[model samples]
Target: MAEEEKTDRIEKRRRQSPKGEERRAEILAAALRRFAEDGYQNAAIGDIARDVGLSLPGLLHHFPTKVDLLLAILAKQDIDSADFIGHFRSDLRSLLKGMVDIFRRNAGMIEVVRAFAILNAESLMKDHPAKTWFLNRTARMQNDIAVTFERAIAEGSIDGGVDAMAMAAELIAMMDGLQMLWLRQPDRFDMVGGLEAYVNRLLTSLGLEH
Candidate 1:
């Protein structure tokens, strides 16, 4: 009887495991909706569970807390960078192209951008998880852009005197600003054209007669 009980428990655990992941994703989806529809402070976990057809316990099983869910959603942006390389295939052009593709693909995740910025603006606190994660993530991306800038300079694709680190920071800042602006006016911003235009300006500044 003990062996049978153990076997039953194993089967039940297996059944619950997949359900746990699915339930967690559902919880996150609903949580994002609630956070978007009603400010994050106003959105409750129970309502998220109800929207996703999961019990509060099930949601908890997937995300230990609300912050965990929020972080997961934010991390989703990095996870969605699959087509990023295609944008910069023949130098920085590929990277720029990837930005256009990514912005288009991640338009929904743009909501996460607004939520984070809003929360961050509410407090200038430094040790918060959202702020830390976003800072680290953007820093990493900037470093990558700096590396790209360095390589382009070596290939004579861009100006050698331009500080890669500074350029990277400026580039990322421009992109982030564009993203927020685009969120507000998708029809007006033209992300693809804007990025291409920025690259052209950089090339022209580098004496490349673009």
Candidate 2:
């Protein structure tokens, strides 16, 4: 009887596992699609739940609030960003290559770029749950790039006299601007091409062999 009970428990757990993971992925996909198409302010939590064939209460059980889901989505993107940055260090060329690879590797992320850009632009609203989080997160990314810049300059791979902070700002601004432009002309913007061009231009201006 004990063995039979153990087997029953195992079967029950096994039956739940795939369904749970499937539901989680379904929720994420629905959120991504809605966020991409309708902007954050316009997306309804119920709609996301409906997209996944979940009741509103069921979705709430997984993510207590809409902001929670948004934060989770951003967190996932942050992990991807960190991985790419980790794989490519202080080299300007590697940085450029990494960005290209990331854009291609997660093409679906471009959808994310749409609504995120809209929200980021209005991030000055103090009540915005994302404002503080986004600000601190971006600051950290800039700090990482600044550190990389410092190392590259010290190693003579990149030129001296460049302010790491300023360079980091410029790089971020360049990428953000390109993303904005890409949304308007997704078919023609060539996201990778623009990033590579900007990096090459910056390197060339600094007298680097990039």
Candidate 3:
């Protein structure tokens, strides 16, 4: 009888663990939409809790604070972004395709994209909660992309004399600028198509593609 009770308890705990994780994920998703639609400054922790059908303390039990929630969201995005590039690390052609794919994915989650853009811009204020996160992310991205460009050069797919870091900066600038423009005129803009076309032109200029 005691062994059976222990086994049942362990089974119940295993089930509850996934349920708790799912609930936390549901909260994060709701918080994401709230932050995206209402800006971080405007989206209070109480509001997020309400949106997720949780009490303030219940929500806090999962995410301690609004800053904690925001960082969690950004951390997820950072991992996805890294995977986006990491998927095609060895293939230059695929790398370009991956960029388009990532942008298209972002377009599908336009609200989240909007949230990211707004938060990124706000982080430029220096005192923003995510300022260090953004700064560190940018530096890491630049270095990662620069290393990829160097690899392309070694493979003879990119011009040997080109400055990898400079090109990485330019690429990031173009993508961010295009996202801003696309957000303003989403219906009229073809962000993924435009990015694909630009990368094609860029590679052609570099003599990697015809």
- Least accurate stretch of 10 residues (summed lDDT) in model 3? 88-97
Expressed as tens digits, the lDDT of each residue in 1-60 for candidate 3 is 799999999999998999999988888898888887788878888988898789999999
Q: TM-score of model 2 relative to the true fold?
A: 0.87
Off by over 4 Å in 1: 39-42, 55-58, 82-90, 108-127, 207-210
lDDT of residue 177 for candidate 2:
84
What is the C-alpha lDDT profile of model 2 across 1-210, one tens digit per residue? 799999999999999999888887789778978987887777899999999888999999989998988888778777766665767765766765676676665455677677778778756676877788789878987887788888888988766888998988888887788888888888887877778777778778877766
lDDT of 1 at 82: 34
C-alpha lDDT values of all predictions: 0.70, 0.79, 0.85
Q: How many backbone clashes does every candidate have?
A: 6, 0, 0
Return whichever of 1 and 2 wins on TM-score. 2
Give the TM-score ranking, best first.
Answer: 3, 2, 1
RMSD of 2: 2.3
For residue 202, model 2's alpha carbon misses the true position, in angstroms, by: 1.3
State the displacement of the C-alpha of residue 179, model 1, in Å, after optimal TM-score superposition.
Answer: 1.7
Better of 2 and 3 by lDDT: 3
Give the per-residue lDDT of model 1 (tens digit) for 27-110.
Answer: 767777777666566668788877877788877877878778877877674576533553464567566556666666666566
Per-candidate TM equals 0.78, 0.87, 0.90
What pairs collide in candidate 1? 87-94, 87-95, 87-98, 88-94, 88-95, 89-94
Give the C-alpha lDDT of model 2.
Answer: 0.79
